[model samples]
Target: MHLPIDLVMKIYYMILAVIGVPVNLVAIVILSRGKCGLSTCTTRYLVAMAAADLLVIITEVILRWINLYYFPVSFLDITPVCSVIAVLKRAATDCSVWFTVTFTFDRFVSICWQKLKTKYCTGRTAAVVLATSCILLSSKNIPHYFVFEPWVIIDNVPWGCATIPAYVTEPGWVGFDWFGTVLTPLLPFAAILLLNTLTVRHILVASRVRKRLRGESKGENGSDPEMESRRKSVILLFTISGSFILLWLVYVVHFLYYSIAGINPDYYKDSISTFAQVGSILQNLSSCTNTFIYGVTQSKFREQLKSAVKYPVSSIIQLIKKKQNN
Candidate 1:
């Protein structure tokens, strides 16, 4: 029996919420402890990404999706409350995307530009960049709150949030929408691609030069620690950035199609609607994949994750044995 698409989406989001939250939390906890053999600056960026992903799951999936599908009536549905939630959701998503861009750039600098790496790749600089990005992105989303109006007025209170019709027609809101879209996935998409290309080019040239200098090109077998280290860094950076591109690619295409055609998604044909929905699903899934990427790319991350998983189970077993003896 074929289940309805809506039902399938609901199940998917429910599962996403359950898995996304704890995994991101685990990632944050593990990465923050600095035991993964990653540099402090890299750790800070990763922890921030995980934290933002956790927030996206809470605000977008649990609060937005589960609430919309399951609990239709709640304080969270109140227009003002829901408006704030909408703003927070956008801000969290923006920070999540932009953080990846910044992290990619940090790795690029560290790999390609040694002179700038010492200053730009420091933990202090990372903290500052993250904080500033968070603040600016959050501020940018404030206008989103004003774009929502009450869906219904019951007695004296606004019951739900509805987009103000002017949001689509008015030049100001339309311009803001364009600005937001450009600021997020669009700009980030281009930035990551360009940065990765440059990083790859630099690495290829440097590898060849280093090989000749170390006499490896002439068959004088010797291990070059510098090249080995660069290989590890390149793997981590490429995996994370590549995952981002692949996951977000559908959503970007959907956005481009609808925007270029000037068609409201609500009026899309069945096929187009399904396409848009798939894009959304993929983008939301993107929020949860970084932890898995880390596990796959970094051996130390896998070790840390295993230790974290065992600690609670081992504690519970010991506690049970002690109580039995008592």
Candidate 2:
């Protein structure tokens, strides 16, 4: 039997909730509790991104799946609940998308502008940037609250509940869609691409300079520790940014097409839906990859993680041994 698209979507969301939630939680905890000070700009941004991703997984992925699969009939009685879910999903997604750009920009500045980095790229600055983005994005999505409304067309029909946007026919919706897509996804993608390229170029130049310095000095067995840290951060940045671009690029292209082409609405939905589903899953999967990247690229993160895991297990072992001896 062919699996239904709704069922496939349900399974996809279930996987995201299972994997993305716990992984992001681990990343937040590890990044926050590790030796990275509270003021460390990168750690703060990473933690914020993880939190935003968790919000997206819960609201957009898991909640949408539940409404579609399990509670399709009676859930609309509480219309406000549906609207809240839509608002949160949009807000969280907006934050998650832009935060990646924010974090990448922070990395670019820290690497490319060494003089300004010390003054501007501190933990406090990171906090300000994250907070400002959150406020701005959240405020921009406030219109969604009014736009998303729950409707019940018939009695005793279990159609499931969803906050459908009520204003799609309005002339302004096209403008809104354009604005939303650009600000939320496209602009951020472009920023990351440009900033990442500049950052890479700076790193290469700095590397050559370091090599020259080493040659002049004659007998240094190790490299500069600060430069080494910058290199590690750049590698992580690339992995995260590359995954974001790969996962979202197709969806973005499709989104722009739908918004601009004015195609017959009924004509392309079936084909569009398939691509949309795949694109969504790929995008959510990117959220689950960051912690693994951190573990793989950063030796310090792995050591901290090992210690964190080992300490709890060792304590349990000691407790069990004492009980057995007693």
Candidate 3:
């Protein structure tokens, strides 16, 4: 029936890592070019998102490659290695959220409200948003460093991987799991829902406005034909945002089940491990999928991605020809 847990996690992570490289690399380049009709203010935030996603894919590749090739069962004895991976995981996820939510608010202001085009929204402003979000998230995760200290004895022994033990930290902080995972990320989910909703609503309202304008000019009776096309694009973009929310919700639910219910993790250990891997990978997909969403829904990001990918290779060939001539 079910595959071995470790085997499944190894395979899943490996596969997702393999998939993430090219996808997120494309994101990094497209966003970097600022060619996606991206305003100066908003491009940097998504660039940070793309960059963070790129680094995250790298770490995922390392962890997966190590898990599959180097040390499948144990062998990761270096506390700093684990700590660094864990820290980077937190950093990437945190920085990514900051970029994501900042972009959400950016869209809200730029599209829905239409006031920020002239105001305090520029490349520098997006940079500051990225910085602030990273700082705040880093502060939140700082406790992990002091709390997850390596017991020298644990490493010296031969018990598979050096494990992070439970209940070894300060008593007050020891069991406050509910406050950590569920409640914290939920606030961000709520914000995402609110802002993304407003953005979608505004996009819809504008489409209607354009259709009304079109119909009045053409002397048509009911609705403009182009309205259907705009509606499909809006729906597709909404689906991308919806994907982010769904994956995070699954993660939060499972996390709350473990933390709040005090369920024996072993009972659902197989499922917990499986879903965790899936959710983790899918969440990272959000970082890369932004480019795809823009590519599909916007046309401009797609053309830009195509040109960016092609132009560099053409330049390399041209350079080679000139060198040969010289």
Per-candidate TM equals 0.95, 0.88, 0.77
Predicted structure with the largest TM-score when compared to the true one: 1
**lDDT by residue for model 2 (123-224), tens:** 899899999999999988887766643345456432324434434445686578678989978998889999998998888888878877778446556758
RMSD of each: 1.5, 3.2, 4.5
**Per-residue accuracy of model 1 over 1-326 as CA lDDT, tens digit each:** 99887898899999999999999999999999999999999999999999999999999999998998889799999998999999999999999999999999999999999999999999999999999999999999999999787878998999887777677667787789889999989999999999999999999999889888888888899888888888998998888888888988898888788767766554689899988888889889988999999999899999999998899999999999999999
Residue 243 alpha-carbon offset, candidate 1, angstroms: 1.3
Residue 111, candidate 1: C-alpha displacement in angstroms:
0.3
lDDT of 3: 0.64
lDDT, residue 108, candidate 1:
95
lDDT of each: 0.91, 0.79, 0.64
lDDT per residue (tens digit) for residues 105-172 in model 3: 77667666656556756788777778887887766766554434554546365322232445323345
